[model samples]
Target: MNHPIAQRVPGRRPAAARRPGRRPAPRPAARRLAPLALLCALASLATGCGIRATSVPVDAGAAPSRVGCVLPEDRERPDGDGADSIVRLYLVCGSRVSPVEREVRMPDGRSATERLPVARELLEELQRQPGAMEDTAGFETAVPNDLKVSGSRDGDPDEALRLNRSLDALPPFALAQLVCTLADTAAADADEGVVLGGPADDEAAGPLRRYECDTALRTHPEAAETAGTDV
Candidate 1:
């Protein structure tokens, strides 16, 4: 019995020499969420470090509407001589344009037929050399004293007035003065604008063209420079 007692097993490790059990693998959802958790942590760190993004205020709708500057209303004097009505005349003052009030004796009639005479008188006033007061105030007019206006039946729309010279012959500033003056008078008659043609005596002249006095033309006479030779 002692002889056959025991033969030690060769090439076998002891129980204490065996490897320890391994930990379980992480779940699929947890593995997928790791990157997301890392991103959230980075964002929080950035915020904590006081980093900020830039932003701009934007106007998301149509722009605000603009209203043009208007001339003062005319003053009415019913009993002050024959010159009882006051009208605004656009005149050049230094580098800018402005309205100058003038008293004109309007005829008793309130018909459109009276517009032509009133327009003529206004033109005369414009052509007259700036008065002492106007000269002192740095006001001036570009209209020529010899320039004349007449009525025409040229069949052009709203074109009832004819100039003494070709529209192209007049300087832009001069033309603006004439156009605005006539337009102001015609407006009183409910006319949209003053339609003007070249000299009535010139048979080769072109047909009439309509002109209006807008805020741009009144406040900025230099705007007429690009109106072309036909204006």
Candidate 2:
């Protein structure tokens, strides 16, 4: 940020004054040369956009509560969409933005997407099953909990959502209701798709990779920028 100018002599004229002001009238050639100095100054120290180091003060209002399932984006996919909905849930969770397009083109030809905000539950679920946590976008929170872990301890948050969705395919929905009842022991307003993956310290390579990868991808883009460049 600091630019060094030639040391100014007290009695002598300053180096800057030696040249006429930037807008001085002169031979047409000199006027054309005027902007070149400023241009060179700009090219020397290159910075992309106005990126400054500061943990962005997260706008909590923009993010949904971790306590419950966020409402579905369209509520109606409009094309007899049912079977694959459950599997698609965990594909993206607990992310404010997706560097890739977070959209799906349904069989009916109309495409729909949602920018699901990342919550602790979503992160916890991803910790359990990183593969399942593909995009972490378009998740619809209709209930308080995504997965129902009534009597398991492996503590895979994201995978549990997939398992619970299987239970959602049950005959009468008794298991899901029971899971919700048990979760109410702690999360009183809990519902489906509200990710509640056991305690946070159960997995090692799951969500940790996501956080690390996301951080690195967002910060050190320069490394990848020139990755495939030809010498």
Candidate 1 residue-wise lDDT, 185-207, digit = tens: 64232555666678877877775
lDDT score, candidate 2, position 55: 92
Q: Pick the candidate with the highest lDDT.
A: 1
**Per-residue lDDT of model 2, residues 1-231, tens digit only:** 888967877899876568665665566877887797667567656852344546978665776556222434654333434532111222222432122112223222111111121222322332343222231323322233444333223533331321233322322222222222222122211222223222243343122110112333223422322211111
Q: In model 2, where is the ten-residue run with the lowest total lDDT?
A: 109-118
Task: Give candidate 2's error at residue 220 in angstroms.
Answer: 21
TM-score of each: 0.57, 0.16
Stretches of model 1 off by over 4 angstroms after superposition: 1-83, 157-159, 187-191, 225-231
RMSD of 1: 12.8
